[model samples]
Target: MSNASPSVKTPLYAQIGQRIGQMIDAQVFRVGQRLPSLRDLASQNGVSVSTAVQAFHWLEERHLVEARPKAGYFVAPRSRRPALPAVSCPPRHSLALQRKSRTETIAVFQPQGQEVTFGAAYPVVSFGGACPKDPLFFDDDRVRVALARATRIHRHSLIEYSDSPGTQALREAVARRALHLGCQLLADDLIITSSCIHAVGLCLRAVTKPGDVVALESPTHFGFLDLLESLNLRVLEVPTHPKQGLSLPALQLALDTQPIKVVLSVPTLSNPLGAVMKHSDKRALVQMLASRQIPLIEDVVFNDLLAADERRKAAKAFDQDGGVMVCGSFSKTVAPGLRLGWVEAGRWKDSVSMLKRVQGGPTNVVLEQALADLLSQAGYEARMRRLGALMKDRLQEARGLINDSFPRGTRVSDPSAGYTLWVELPGQLDAMALFQRCVAEGITFGPGALFTATDRFRHCLRLSFAGAWTDVERRALARIGELARRQGDAP
Candidate 1:
């Protein structure tokens, strides 16, 4: 078990912290519940009190527990005990994607991009960013060395065009990674694209023509909406739980009622909401789609960020008849600069491969080789753990601030892992109006209106904590809440 654990290379106290973490996750110890005294834990585990203290400290750093002056240790409340956002039930009818003006699209799309300044000389603090930016989350030196080694090794390949379906080494590397998601994919079936978004676009193109209907989670990733619009596809948004992911029953109903050609979802650590489907539910989702012959474009870009191996298993693992097209990239969890993403197209392999060649073509083989090297290296899981902990600390702290500073009745999500929080402000407080106010002050977050084609989420916003968290950033977050509070009862 130790050999398999990402925390194996960590200190012994940290390893013990893992055990306590499992307990916490399983609800053997409820949130805000007190744990045994340090002495009792030491006696139970046959270690000294000093070691137990260190173990508790390790958990504290990860925000799994808190130390009080005389209250001993208690399980830290997730998202500071805020009421979770209610399950979303978007309008049942499938509707064509609305095309926005380029200027409006740029205003919303700019936040999700990696660039710091969006052509504005004035500085803006973005809370809508999706990529992790802090250096503490990844080992930059390791990435540099890997890139250099791959460059030296594959120098001759630069003059060569990478194979249409990607290099064998990178494909094999992705197959190996699929194992972590409980998938035993064949490397031959994989096609490397520019990014996960690109892979999804290819999948959509391969399966459906323009004006085809697709069913996706409500308050879905805004990027998906943008892609659907570009493809001229219609969408039906299904009801989705904040923590459990897409509602299968709603999806089934949509399939029966609408001409849904595909289902696109982020089953594990879904963007913005960070929902991880239950294992049984994942299997059910695959089976449901397979029975209907409806293709599923499953996005697993954030799968590796989850801590538990069992929980990391993807819905694609349950695919039996090639109905699931699983897409992923390491840019979010590993190297953001690398424009590398892969997809196993299941039954639509040939179609997706052809689309890859016809569309943007293959990525740089040398960079792919570097990404392969990075993926196959040891301590990858440990790096993910580091990222998880860093995000955990910040998210908990942000939740606390939201609790104190946001409008009354404000609700936020409690994700298993990842860097974003879906905040539901008071219903009367228009989140788009709030976003405009924040932007005027040089601050920005994903307005709820941006996430959906409909207006259901007009009071919500997705706050991202992936970037550097300085005092200025903290104050900016607090300021957003202040504005929301002021506008809580406004018309």
Candidate 2:
């Protein structure tokens, strides 16, 4: 057979696709709007008919455009567009009624960076997204030795399916570590998960049926609230304190009156508020939950970030009747991309482990083993110490900036641990509006409303100092404060 020549590549098709994508992004061709016919597009893009056809086919496959029989390609309708499930909320009067102009209703201040992402709870700084900076005394040698050991022992098996409960060594490490928290857990008590979020999901699936009522912190982690909504669970909001954590009395009232199956909360280092439950409150709450047989899901992702003395206490520490399902993750302390987290399922270990199997078969074995190896290193504890100091310093720097720059009436939270600062703005200043303005300026943050069932904290905002240079963060803080003042002054 004669050799065939390679087909010539077409640049025109790519250019046409780019143009169409740009138009879609800019909303020049809005959702549901009919796209130009192949003939028309070829004429407009100055390309051959085949080139335009190729481009349209490419776009259609990627879901940016949809082909309609006899109608040609139209911008995908809203229903057809790929989207995250709509987060549910109770109906409320629109904020539009308060402002004279619709434009005025939206915050105009732009954070010095990109999109209006303040609605999402993430740190504006690069480092704020995940683990904190390591301190001066971290021992890298120990980590290396541990990895070497894991490799020598596991070798080929590292790539194979891990036991449902995770590596025995890792489970034992976790159980031994739990002892510091006053939790007397055996290896059997732990069910390893990909992340704390996964752990929470498994616990939810294990305990409650779909449509069961779950009580959550009024302004809790939006991710959890969204998860509950997706699982078709009805959420009942329980009021929480900004500093002391969830309200015990309110939780007690809800427990007594409502048919709540689970209470999800962050007893230590809450996401937006940076609240830590008092020891007495933790005892009372645990007792209450145990007495009522209510499962308490404690998100302790930030647990290890606490100072040494603080490590001795945990919500699980006080669970006399195994009512607390403690979920902890190395993502916050180590690396998030590693996705190493575990659930100390007090009484629901088998149920959670089974759910883990159903959800994704099993987590990445090599990654989990790598993390286990890293933990085995003596350097892990030293690295944690260093991270703690750096975080403490960063927290102080961010707190000072907020206190100095924010408007006079603004109340900044005084968190004993964790890198988040919760600022309570004047009632008139909507954090969501402020978020939009900041996003336009190239900054992003976690808005207050997403954390709550009601818009009760519309005036509040959470800032993370986990990442970013001190100079950039200080400037961002000053700009944020100025924006708050402007919004507060606005009629």
Top of the candidates by TM-score: 1
lDDT for position 287 in model 2: 91
- Clash tally, candidates in order: 0, 19
RMSD of each: 5.3, 21.2
On lDDT, the leading prediction is 1
Residue 49, model 2: Cα distance from true site in angstroms: 77
Assess each prediction's global lDDT (C-alpha) against the native. Answer: 0.85, 0.68
Q: What TM-score would you give candidate 2 relative to the actual structure? A: 0.71
- TM-scores for all predictions: 0.84, 0.71
Clashing pairs in 1: none
- Model 2 regions lying over 4 Å from their true place: 1-155, 309-312
State the number of backbone clashes in model 1: 0
Per-residue lDDT over 32-96 for candidate 1, one digit per residue giving the tens place of the 0 to 100 score: 89999999999998899999999998788657899988989999986546799999979989888
Query: Model 1, residue 402: what's the lDDT?
Result: 85
